[model samples]
Target: MIPPRFAVTEDQIAAVVAEFYTCVRQHPGLGPVFAAHVQDWPAHEAKITRFWKNAILFDRGYDGNPLAVHRAAGDVRIPMFDVWLGLFDSVLRRELPSETAAAWSALVHRIGRGLVFGLGQAEGAPPSLR
Candidate 1:
């Protein structure tokens, strides 16, 4: 039998991206923001594919700035970040096994919070570092 790998494969990345967007589209807090900002989803889909693929694979394929993309998307309100995180966590929990799911859950939460808080800081907002 083959050992389970810690790394997320290309197919897994694709699935995650697709699931993520689907969840985002359905999430009440995040749906409108997504619909408004994500006008061209195919390109965004490819970009997220590259992003997660590189993030998990340590490859050099991803080049887009997530921070910049979110910044350009002025539709995201303060509560949307938490809502997005919840949806992401929900999707992850539903898809992965317990151990792998836990790891990815922690990773996504940490990274999502960091990104949102960092963006807040950069925008001269009050500290969102919680």
Candidate 2:
């Protein structure tokens, strides 16, 4: 039998993104790193909301090169991915149903690993030392 697919809506995605960022902004380690790059929370949240809509719904609303942006940031480290994913998992699980949370978690993990690989830090080397 085929597994049941969760119908993820825009509202759900928006809520998840908002709550996830709230946690990120309050996080001890990840908060400072994000603040250094994202000066405007409202704009950043809007962009990320579009990003998630496009990613999860194929809405074609987002067009930014996330890998390039992260690479240009120049200060992101390998371990930071761990923190980001951990917080993301926490928020998603808390705010969404299990099926939705699992789906988003899988996609986010794939994206995070790809970003780490693109940053040349997949082998656990910090970007600052690379």
Candidate 3:
């Protein structure tokens, strides 16, 4: 089973988030879009930290709506979503144990899918793709 807080320590979460962003920034297909959207990298990092903390561990510290945030980002293409998930999965795999990574992967996959699907719907596409 997954711990509500994901890792045992906040430092572990910080490490995972840092590594994930580092991977995304280096990925050829994803880096440009991320750079464009995340102009304020420090603020973006904090927002993502809160998002993951809330989603994976039920922490109430994060009040941002991730779906709405991505929806407002007009540059979020489908391939960008794919690359984001790929980087997240890859980085988490490198940072966490098998079981922890598995749990985190599942949640990240769902979040990524929802973000993409929300974009599709906003663009008048079918919801079935979700």
Best by TM-score: 2
TM-score to native of every candidate shown: 0.82, 0.86, 0.84
As for candidate 3, its clashing pairs are none
Per-model tally of clashing residue pairs? 0, 0, 0
lDDT tens digits by residue: candidate 2, 25-118: 8999988889999999989999999998777777777989888888778788878998899999998999888988998899999999888887
Which of candidates 2 and 3 is the stronger one according to lDDT?
2
Per residue, candidate 3 scores C-alpha lDDT tens digits across 54-106 of 77777777887777766777777776777677778888888888888888888
Error of 1 at 96 (Å): 1.7
Which whole-number lDDT from 0 to 100 does residue 90 have in model 1?
80
Per-residue lDDT tens digits for candidate 1, residues 16-68, read 77899987888776777778877888888888888876666666689887876
lDDT of each: 0.74, 0.85, 0.76
Which runs of model 3 end up more than 4 angstroms from their true locations? 1-8, 123-130
